[model samples]
Target: MSSLAYGSFCATCCNLIPPETEPLACSTCAKPCCWKCAREPAESVSLFNAPAVICVACDAAMDLRGGGKMVPKPPMEQGLQRCRMHPERFLNLFCLTCQVQICCDCFVVQQDHKRHTIDSIEEVYRQKLLETVEKFREIPKRLKLVDWEAVRQVEENLKIIQEMETRILGDIRQLFQQRTAIMLNKTAEKKAVLQKTKDFVDRTEMQHRQTLESIQGLNTNDFLRLQAALNERCESILKDVGQLQVEPVRWDDIDCDLLPSCKLQPISLNLPNGDAAKEKHVQIQLIDDCGIVWTTTFFIGGQSLALEMKPNRQLDEFHFKAIVEMSHSSQIKVSGKSFSFKGFLAKNELISLPKLNSGGYLTDTGDLVMRLGIRPENILEESDLLKALLVQQRKLNSQLKVENATLKDQNFILRGDMLRVSSESQQNKETLETQVVALTRRLKMFQHNSYVHNQTLQVRPQTPISPVSQPEDDKEKLSSDMQMLRTKLDEMKTSMKAMNPFAIGSFEIYRWSKDSKFYSPQVASHVGVTIYIIVQPNFACEKSSDVNAYVCWAKGPKLRCQIFIEVVNEFEDECVREDRVFDFSKGTSFTWKSVISHYNLFRSDGFLSDDHLKIKFGVRPAVE
Candidate 1:
């Protein structure tokens, strides 16, 4: 036996195989070979040459049928092959031209297949074998190049995807950090804003509590107004918070309903198991949102009371009186005035006690001995002295007012008399001037009469009976009347010369005794003697006199007189003056003013038990 060791052999253990066998065989075994063992077989070779090479047993089966080696098998013998005409048999061979395979029966009998060119099993098999070998040789190189290119492409795609994924992850991380920072900052800002909001709400609620307490003890229009204002502020705060852009986390805490509710109850110290005593001195504290507390006292009768207490502190049962006072320093006259109420906690109501008779006395001490259930008339009567004093003061003030009015009337009459006297003197002088003019005309007429008589005497050649012709009685009567008229005129002139005008000067003093009139006696004397003349060219002037002077007691020592007269009476209608004699002899002061139209200056001395003398002076015009 021989082996074919070169063609299509399994490339291992070739030395153990034999050559020159018709088919390759195993070198180590002496068995007939088919292609599986002959080409590179570990067996004996067979002695057959068939187109489709096979083992000896397989070749012999073909020879038993015919001498041809190209015998075909049934269609089913090949995988997925079936006879075309027979529905159950697969037609295996495919014809390229006719585009169909034929079974052995069809080749012999089918009319469609009889005229077509046919390919035998050996011819088709050989042609297919060469084509298959050519295709097989080119497929691996092309596949290898394609696989390498696919690997490169896959690597490039994976790298790009990896870079993009990294960038996306980095962006996501930075975005998360940025959002966190923003959220944290906003949270801090919101907390600060919320704190402020809480503070404001707290303050407003505190104000509401204070106002409510005030309304409890004292009910007034002012307190009511304050309460309304507080309510409005609370509402405004709530509305403002509602309009905020951010939703607050802890808004419920500031709700007024959730906050403390306080009511004023009579603190009864007389409860059982209690050494009952009224709260004699309690401190009233006013708290703000900032935790600052202001301490004040609520005084009732002579004792002080408190309004609020700490939350944790115990409230001892006690009954105390309280008086709340509020002041507004805006009214001009009534700023420091007080509104007082004497009240005690009776049952639950605040009962007001009767007012004391003593106006200035704060409380009735004797009323302490009188039981709460009883009213003491004796204490009420005991306070009568103070009440009577008040009444007496009122009466004395009325009398003093009446006396002052009487003095004012007397002064007015005196001033009226002066004005009348001055006006009468001026009228008298005008009348005298008119009378003088008439008297001159009358004298002229009398002289003419005498001249006419003398001329008649000269023309009648010395008539010698003048004693017999003249009426002596008529002449004597005329002379007597003239002498009386002249005497009356001389008396009028003397009276006009005696009437002098003067101005009043001013002086202010802090203290005025009962002998104030005596102290300034020289003032009155000067009023009668020294004349005060004001030279005012704008107005009608009586006489050009420079005796007007001023004296002010408040000036102390450096008192001097500077007189002025009108100069350049056009645009500059002002007075120019030089200092004259400064007189300080008249009780260290002296002043005068022209008594124009008989105007007199009068003084009012305001005297009271509570206050020192306050005086005022004025020169009033005559009523007439």
Candidate 2:
């Protein structure tokens, strides 16, 4: 370290360490010197590890072993030299066998390793480096080829699988459609069967209802008599109890155990009915335990009848006949009577005649009771008989009640059967629904497989194989020969409307007649001249003449005949007149139109619109 001293006199002072305390020699010179005048020694260039020394006089360096200063030399002077045996003077080569650097002369002329390959040193180095780089560059291309080959195989397999899936799915779809159709058909058939069963049940129920109603109404008179008898017995018992000073008891409760539950037996019959129009006769005999017997004889008109009776049935072999009067109003009477044949049925009877009432209304079932002598002439006797008939009525009422209960039980069973059928139908419906769901799921899976196959086929490249395999050519031909059935379903819905009625023009009457015996002949013509208008054969036509009218013209030589009618004058003598207009435009084919005139044409009273003249037309011609 050197120190600089400063003082008030402004003179510079240098400080230096003495060698005894610290080394003050220069690093380069190794000489003790004052700080202000010290100099650095020159650098040594020796290639030896000896301590360096410098000459201060010449400022030169010397090696420790007395050698000169070191200097960096060019390659030619240090080591790079041409081979001795070759003419080349450069060393830019390699010894191939020895793998050592050499000049071109050594590479070509060295006999010991002349057969080995030799090249420029830089060229060999570059070639080895390029080879290493190229080897690394080829790896990705090889890997790509492997990947493409594997992908191609995978795609081909997928394509084949897809084709198989497509075929299978097509079959599945067809099967589903067929099954759906079958299910629908089965459902329809089941519905039809159900409807038929329902109809049967309904019909049976109606019959039961009718039977119950009939039973309820049976022997109402008998029940009344029994009630009266019961009341009389109760009254007598009450009187006896009063006499004994005892309390009256409830007879109904006391006798409840003794009273048996009544039962009913249905009636069966073999009927004897013959054709009424062909002079067939009917006879019925009713006998009671008291030997009171009744017999009836009847003659029928078609299925309808006119009947006569001997109400005094105790007579032996009574015979009677009647004047059979028939009417168009569904009313026929041997004499004035109203009767029905619905009240005379008995259980298990072989009736020899169709049941008939004195009143004449027929029933499909011949259950009519003969209510004889309903006329006012025999009212008293008929009343008495009706009264006497009430005695046996109570038994009929009990029988009817039991029958009704049995029918109700039968109806309940039928309802249970109906409910069970409905439940079965519902179960079938649910099963069908489940089947549909299963099919849907299978279809979806098939669709998914098909999609996957399609994707594979799209990505895959084709192979150059023949369509048919060599061994399967015959089998493929069979596929080609399969029958192709093309089915076309056509549905036609047709709705039909009702047709309008046919219309005809007004009626035309060519001729008419009027006589002196007629009263108010013109008014009679107006009332009786029915213009039978035909709107249609089935539809009734309006009788109004506003539709059209017609006139009647006489058909004769020179048209001299005019339509006429006879009328009475103030002198009570007969006069011929033509008063009304013979309108034809208002006439239909079935309608009639007429105008009246006198016996001669152009008579004073023969005006077409005059009164006191009658006109009529029929199929018959004018009478003489």
Candidate 3:
């Protein structure tokens, strides 16, 4: 036989060996391998009849062993491959920080992996595979529970949406019903007023026809006798017509836009006195939605009475007063623990009603009811009206003169007060500054002393000189003093700010009315400088009414201001404007009258729109 030569290389170590030396060959891969690189056949491979050793590579290549022919393992099951960056080395470690598999070379040499936490791939695989299998097994149950919860949530949300929709729809319908009721009530009121006017007109017409017939049938002698009476009757009829014309039954313009509705709360009243006969005074109050209170006080005497009506709150622009005579017939009723008053009210006159023991014409929930009628004697002649006008004008002029004088006095007082306050503020500021400076100097001295103490202690550690506890004590005391000084300084600064007079602020603009005259609230600036405007309605005046603007220097130093007044139209672009420069010195308030005509304010083609008079005011410091 030819000498056995080294034929094939061992599959495990790839070493050449002699065939005659009986080198092991793998049954699966048919690769020759050295004895150290061989492994016994699996127990399931009993058909081979004899035990055989296979090369390590052939054993590794077989994924499922023993029962069948060699089956190659999948790429994933072949363990970690070489790293992409460094193909020569196998990827043995996983980077926890980077979440990537890296070889030993990449982990040790690459800058990117320097800070990354690395774990062996086999260990990570063993942990992650078991966790993944457990999680995979739980997926179905978790998905089922999540799906059920989502469905339940969807159902609940749908129910809530439906309920909200129902509630909103119900609210809308209720609002409409309420609005309709209000409209119906207002219509009925208008109808009643119109019916009353119609009845008055019919009665007057019938009387006039009867008088004309009597005049036509009268003889010359009778006519002369009745002429004076007939003339008086005619004049009375004409006066009635004029009065009707002056106060017509006209519908008030209603705004369709919705406004916040206020509940009609019951008005609380003070306990009533025993009876109208014995009571010396009676008070009645009416409060509006805007918190305005109108009070009427009745001073009762044996046969005479005085009624005083006024606003509970002080008004800036206008005041109201009415003087009237009371008739003996005016009376009050008290029964069932309720108070009721009924009286006939005329211009400067009142006729009392009969006292009721149990019941009377007690409207307004048995409160007070006044069925007042104008007395015929209240009518005035043309000459009398003229005289009244002249008297009113003279009264207003005299009142203005007096007010001007009072304002001058107030101005002088304010000037003195301002000077005193300034002096006090200056003194307080100086005192605080001096205190702060002294405290700062003391704090610096304490710090210097402590530093010197610390240095001496450092230099003379063995010296018998007791460490000066005084420096530490002094330092703590100085720090506390500094803190107290800071607190006092803050308080002083706060007080100074409170004393400042030039600060500016604003408030809400409000509308008010008295005796059919419209007015604006007194709008004041931060320094207590204020302004208000009034529109006075006068049927007899040339322009029907006069608009006035008042500027008041209620407090603070004298100021020169430019005041701009505008009447804007809600429906139109055009507006009526007036501008004036006024010097408000001392505590004087200046009034500018007849700045604009009332006719222009109320005219259909003018500034008033939607029955609303929009007034705008612009106040600025006047140029020197």
Point to the candidate with the largest TM-score.
3
Report every candidate's CA lDDT.
0.39, 0.38, 0.53
**Model 1, TM vs. native:** 0.19
My TM-score estimates for the predictions, one after another, are 0.19, 0.19, 0.26
Superposed by TM-score, candidate 2 places the C-alpha of residue 568 at a distance from the truth, in angstroms, of: 61
Where model 2 places Cα greater than 4 Å from the true spot, the runs are: 1-388, 465-624
| lDDT (Cα, tens digit) per residue for candidate 3, span 1-624 | 011112334656766554445444444543445544344444555356554443365453322224333334323325557678877656757899988887766866688899778776655887899999999989998999999999999999999999999998998788878878877887788678778888999999999999999999999999999999999999999998877632222112232224322222222222232464445666666443334465656555444334554555444333222222111112322121111121222222132323421234334333443321111112232234335546767999999999999999999999999999879976876676576567567657666766776787567545347555555566677577657766765665555444443323222223334346555554536334566665554444332333443333445457776666666655546666776777667655464545555533444555433334556665555432
The order of the candidates by lDDT, greatest first, is 3, 1, 2
Model 1: per-residue Cα lDDT over 137-157, one tens digit each: 999999999999999999999
Locate the minimum summed-lDDT window of 10 residues in model 2.
488-497
Q: Write the per-residue lDDT of candidate 2 for residues 1-624, one digit (tens) a residue.
A: 111111101011223333223222223322222322223323453343554445453354422332222223323223445555543344545667887766534534456557777554445767888998898889888889999999999999999999999998998788777766766776677577657656765765675576556556759786565666655655764564344321211111122211221111111222235553446556655332223343445554444444433443332222211111221112322222333222221122212233343233333554332233212113343344445545545667778899999999999999999889868755764554455555455556555655665576667666668664333443343333321100100100000001111111122222223221222112111212322211111112221111111232222112111123323233343433332323322323332343332233222433222322223322111111
Which scores higher on TM-score, 1 or 3?
Answer: 3
